[model samples]
Target: MLESLSVPKRRVAAQFVLPGGSSRKVAVFLAEAVPGREGGERLSDLLNGSGPRFIPAHDAETDAMTFVHRENLALARVAAEHEPNVVDPFNLPTEHEVELRLVDGQALHGIIAYVLPEAHSRLTDYLNSAPPFFPLLEEGGQHVVLVNKHHVAYVETLRR
Candidate 1:
């Protein structure tokens, strides 16, 4: 008799701010094996693999675990295979076209549409000319800051 292989569940929690100024929570589960890979690698495989087609966005971070607006459709489909309950309520646009003003007084515009949650406030405040923004780092046995999907300026990933 053959034993059945039981798959472990994977869960990702995130919060998003819609274009209408409303905030919502989202949870998704990627394949257990694929989720462990680096974000960029996973996305590359997903796109190049013979499974599905998802557009890659420039200006999007290549290593974040979160999905951006442009990738909403592809992510949704992938998530559905594992957990049908996971869905992207906000339809992601083909690209993110918003103009961002960085803390260094530089304006940046890109089609990237998602960011880490923990970096949201800092990014927002920086864009508003409130303070400087720095990437989170660990120093002296302590983390300098915590970055989540919200804190990111945009999202990127293919699948795997």
Candidate 2:
């Protein structure tokens, strides 16, 4: 009876970093299917979505379920493939290479690609209008760092 009413989900492994420099390995549960996507909802979507302020995940160290506060997270690291695609068939994405310095003094270097209206396509414009949690494709494109804007001290644009 319970199985019939259960929502299908998939576990995506990730590293959760707290604002104080602590880190944990966890498995984030995501819906098995979502509208407009074939595989599942990307990690970026889950972090940036307006659905909830807490993220449900399974803690590897504790071997238990845990809910992480979105605003308290410094960044969550996941495989690049698990991140949402920035490309839009109609509008080309704007790529900016940058270094994000967090409030805790940690710096992360990556490429932030986003699609914005022609009038607001600059890096500053995109950053100002981006969701609280945004995806940053790390150098080499192997991982996606979902950074919390509230924890970011500043962003420095790098020469491409």
Best by TM-score: 2
Model 1: weakest 10-residue lDDT segment is 74-83
How close is every model to the real structure, measured as TM-score? 0.25, 0.93
Instruction: Name the runs in model 2 displaced over 4 angstroms.
Output: none
What shift in Å separates residue 143 of candidate 2 from its native position after superposition? 0.4
lDDT of 1 by residue, 1-160 (tens): 2335664434444333333234334443334565544332222233224643333222223343444442232111112122121114564322223443322233333322223333443434333432122222222222212122233454222221
In TM-score terms, candidate 1 sits at 0.25
Worst 10 residues of 2 by lDDT: 80-89
